[model samples]
Target: MSVSPGIDRTTLRTTVAVLVGGIAVILDSTIVSVALHQLAQDLDVGVSTIQWVSTAYLLALGVVMPTVGWLQSRLGAKRLWLAALTVFLLGSVLCSFAWNADSLIAFRVVQGVGGGAMLPLMTTIVMQAAGGHNLGKLMSVVALPTAIGPILGPVIGGLILGVGDWRWLFWVNVPLCVAGILLAWRLIPADEPGRRVRLDIVGLLLLSPALVGLLFGLSNVAREGGFGHPDVLLPLVGGALLLTAFVLWALRRGGEALVDLAVLRSRPTWSATALLFLTGASLYGAMLLLPLYWQQVRGTDALGAGLLLIPQGVGSLVSRVVAARLLDKVSPRTVAVAGFALVGVATVPFALAGADTPIWLLLAALLVRGLGMGMVVIPLMAVAFVGLERPEVPHASILTRIAQQVGGSVGVALLAVILATAATSKGSITSAFDIAFWCATGFTALAVLLAFALPSRVGLDASAGGGTPATGAPPGPAADATEVGKRASIAS
Candidate 1:
């Protein structure tokens, strides 16, 4: 597949600017995770109450994400990005000054609104600028936060709380946000808002509540009883029904729909979307498991848990350069398959980790696991856009992102249930960890299976300009739809 020729200096600066913004959003997510305990004490609230520090943000994020496609079309990418940065910055300041639990949760909502829009916008900006050819490498740079945040967030949060207060977590976002806003204004090119700018108000209403209900339901299940409780069952069933209704509605609207379900007619897109979900479950599920093991099982403090995770981040960083270079040369199928296999292998040691497991051994396991994560991230991200038209990138981003986010919510819930169940047994902490690790392994294996859905080749005649395909080219439904179905059938 052709890489887009090197970008001009101006566009390069813009890309960097957008990447900085993307990193800021990632950093926020991880940084807050470490500060939950401190925030709870500061506000004199229970863990459950302070938990909304993250939950509120997540809820707002879910509510806002579906609107990104509509907003970008209405406001243009640059304007939307700058507006998001400005809002995020203000939210950070408000959070820093929050006096109580209720107030902090309120500010987090503001932060979420902006943060939710940031991710899709980030993907849209870089992908559009790259114009498709060198996507693997471009995505590597764009995906740096996935590698960086898990390593940096906990360490930074620990240090901040160590030196000052939990408020520092919010303060940390200040300089980053300021830098992001200035860079975005200076670097991002202006785009004319497209003519087809009608907002999908109906779809947004349906999708938003559906996502919120689903996440809320999962969080409930994570808390105590399973979905047997009315609280969980109501939202879970309602969310499912709402999502089903929206799918039916989206199918009827077709091209004019909010999500553009038509894109799934492409076999590669469908496979990539599935892989994204599994990756989220495998990766984020591990993320949830590791820190808890460190803090609860190994008796490490938050800082120590964060520090142990650094090795994994290092491995991920190392893999990025290699993965980016190899992406265009080899099929994503091969690269992604290898990546998930490595990830599954890395989890074996953790599956057997005991109370006295050596630090060096654990770090070694993390290094390899991190490497696997890097492998999965770059290829998965790049492949999603491989055969997509430029105009379709936003649609693809929304679909894959929704899959990953929902997957993460489900993953955390799954781990919660596993931990709760294992805790009830007479098994040692090591035995419990073994169980969670096995689940993580299974998830990675599923991702490996899903990778086969990706095309085995890079360049295809399906799209043009290595970026946007010809406008009037028949949609995938008209092009080998049966063949696509055959591939899925064969794989299953």
Candidate 2:
């Protein structure tokens, strides 16, 4: 089962297969961002109704993510993933045939359920197969969609919309899905299913509704004047209380509850999760700023704006190899602190750029910002797993992903609020853009503080995290409990 050293053939093949599938999910998630307007018109619905398409997908995804650890243990990775892919494909087909906004949004729920399962499962599968080694390089391979999605999704959506129709966006997923299924079948390992364990039905019900209500509250806050509105306040407060309840319930269960919160006691886990939130704020905040700045201030069309983003994507892709290598050799703290500093510095140019700023200069700033982004994402992810047990990896993966997704939503909402208020008083698109850029800079600066929380030095073993001493699992009815406990110990 040992993979050979230095990008072994089997590892490379498996990594590529997993990543190809990942690209489809990530791409589809973001592609709809650029197509919403077109979709509303084609379906003859108001923009408000069309908004449900993305929201439903996001809500469904968030609800399902925390369940992934249990699903993998019970269903096995291959079966769960293949079932997810089948659901997603069917959803895509349904979406393409939708005659109304409501139908499309409803179908997107199906897609989201499938999509939600795939992301964490992909991370769990790929990282586990790497045997808790070479996390940096493997993350780089996996990080492709995060970097490329912003570029590809918008551009592809714009191109397809310009030449044909909004349905083409869904159409694009077909070929990729087919290829992914085949590659997954051929390359992914088919381990025997694990023994059945008690499913936390109560914990899942509590968590999912809480997450949806929270996200809904936040979205409503963005829409209905302010957070003080009853619609916003009720759900937001209720959701927070529910989440708190889940936490208490989980802790009372002695860490065997849904999320395994005990793992947060691990310094690496806490630090990594914190950095994940900051990274989400910075990365997603900047993504919002660049495009709006181009279209609103510089008057670039959708395609032109997408073209301007190319340098940023290129910078991210180029940095991956270097960042991956540096992570294995350098201290995670040192790498992350420097990365945030670079991101903060790069934001200054955009914050100060005028409508007349030269294209080349803007592109250069994006390239620098993108490099910092890659550095932040890859290392933050790599350092988070350091000293984790194999079993805890899935839980950690789910938490990090959830944190980032929520952070992104917050970042976008905050920026939107800022831009809205600023535009009224500032009186110019450039002014709004500059104000938002400064906000983004602040987010990156905060990331530096979180980065310092990571281990000050590297080269730590996966099983050597600073926390409670390791303990074997309590006896369970299932035969696989021992195996699960060993894996969970490493991750915990």
Candidate 3:
């Protein structure tokens, strides 16, 4: 059957199948944040020990992400997706049966292995299937988990904790994974196995540890004595050195590296990556602050704070269709600039407001913040792949995913440091939150500046009758693959 110029039935089914699995991963990521205290109490572990439940998951995720492109190439999309889903299902079941903090943390790492691969692989498969047409609309569909996860994850966690045992948290994922695996088997097309690609062992050694070190160091900022602590400084510095080594190594290996480093040369690719970093810091860093602000300053409980944040989620949801249309009609630059500016403006109220600022006003600001986030994130994600060929899309997805993940970690750490330093003084929690919001505002402001570097319109080589090579006239195969692969690998 001939597919439409836009999304087709097969595409929609593929997207849905991917999203079903994707949602489970997303929810699991955030849902456990609220359960730390409960888990600590239940397991008879200190807060510090129980916290590894989240930390171990994050570190495992960072370690696994760099391997996804190679793994996908080795296994094909359908097999990889089912394997990841099954691993997650197994991990979730193991976690539910954990008898101690040590066991749970180990189980969480297992879950992270599955989740880390699923994150980038989801995008790789979807975009490859879409063949790079109607990206703006497709991205809106892809972004649904990210938009709702922050707002709803905590609420769901709270509800689960409110009624049932802590183990139910992991148990919830069982049904989702089961359903996801069954649906994927029924819906996703099978791929013919390709020739085995040798794993980039040396590059993997350098890059995976680099990511682990960096994420571990960043995760310690709030708990350790800020950047000055040896615990934080050693890993952060070590990670940086390893990452530098990996870059040099990848450059030397060229297309053969675990992650292709050549994609950074593309103006659109690098620019979108930079913007995604800032967006991550702004979105996630602010998320760290918002719930705490309500709970600490306003004295709302966890569930209440989550409920209050629903306006932001609602705003994001409402704006998706409109933002998708705008992306199709206007330049991504225009939409992104406007979106970041809106985010900056919306954040100013939180930065300047007093503790007693009206509830309705804060909620309204959240709505606008959500709207701007939708606008900024959708286009930034779509623009990253605007001009790329099919094979390169997987690498680009991995690159963008890494950018956003690292960005969120950095953002959270920076704000955490700021809040910690500010809180030590004899001022109220409100002042600390205000200062953090100002810092977040600074991030959006920077993103607005960077968005100018994004492609002014959709598609690479638009003048040459823009579309994927599959849709338009194909380019010279050898030259196009080499260049595209280089850039895509670099970006990944």
- Kindly list the per-residue Cα lDDT of model 3 for residues 1-492, writing each as its tens digit: 444356777767787888888888988877887788788899998766876887798899889999887887788878888999899989999999999999999999899999999998888777766676677888888899888787778899889999999899988888889989988998777664444668899999999999999988887777546798887899999999999999999999976788886767667778998899888888888888787778777888878888999999988887777789897678889989988998889889899877789999999999999999899988888888766655566677778988999898888888877876676662566777788789999999999888888877666223211333222122110000111111111211
Q: Write one digit per residue (lDDT tens) for candidate 1, span 1-492.
A: 233354445546666898787787888888888777677777899866877777788788889888888787777778888999889989999998998999999999999899888877788777676566566766677778888888898899889999998888888888998899888877777665654557778988899999999877766665546667676789889899889989999999987788888778877778888888888778887888888778767888889988989999999999998788777578888889999999999998888888888979989989998888898888878777766776677778888888888887777667666755665573455676688789889888888887887889865223411333112111111000111111111211
Q: Which residues of candidate 3, in runs, are more than 4 Å off?
A: 1-5, 460-492
| Residue pairs with clashing backbones, model 3 | 260-489, 260-490, 261-490, 262-487, 263-487, 399-492
lDDT of each: 0.76, 0.73, 0.79
For model 1, the superposed segments whose C-alpha errors exceed 4 Å read: 1-10, 460-492
**Candidate number with the higher TM-score (1 or 3):** 3
lDDT of 2 by residue, 1-492 (tens): 454355556656777777777788888976777777677778888755777787788788878888887787777777777788878888998999998888899999999898989987777676666655667777787888888887787788778888997887898888888888888888876755554556787788888788887777655544536567786689778888888998888788754677767767778778888888778767776776677678767888877777889888888887787788787778878878887888899888998999888988989988988888888788777766677666676777787887787777666666666766666567776777788789989988888877888888765335422222211121111000111111111211
Q: After superposition, how far is residue 299 of candidate 2 from its true place, in Å?
A: 0.4
Ordered by TM-score, highest first, the candidates read 3, 1, 2
lDDT of 1 at 126: 72
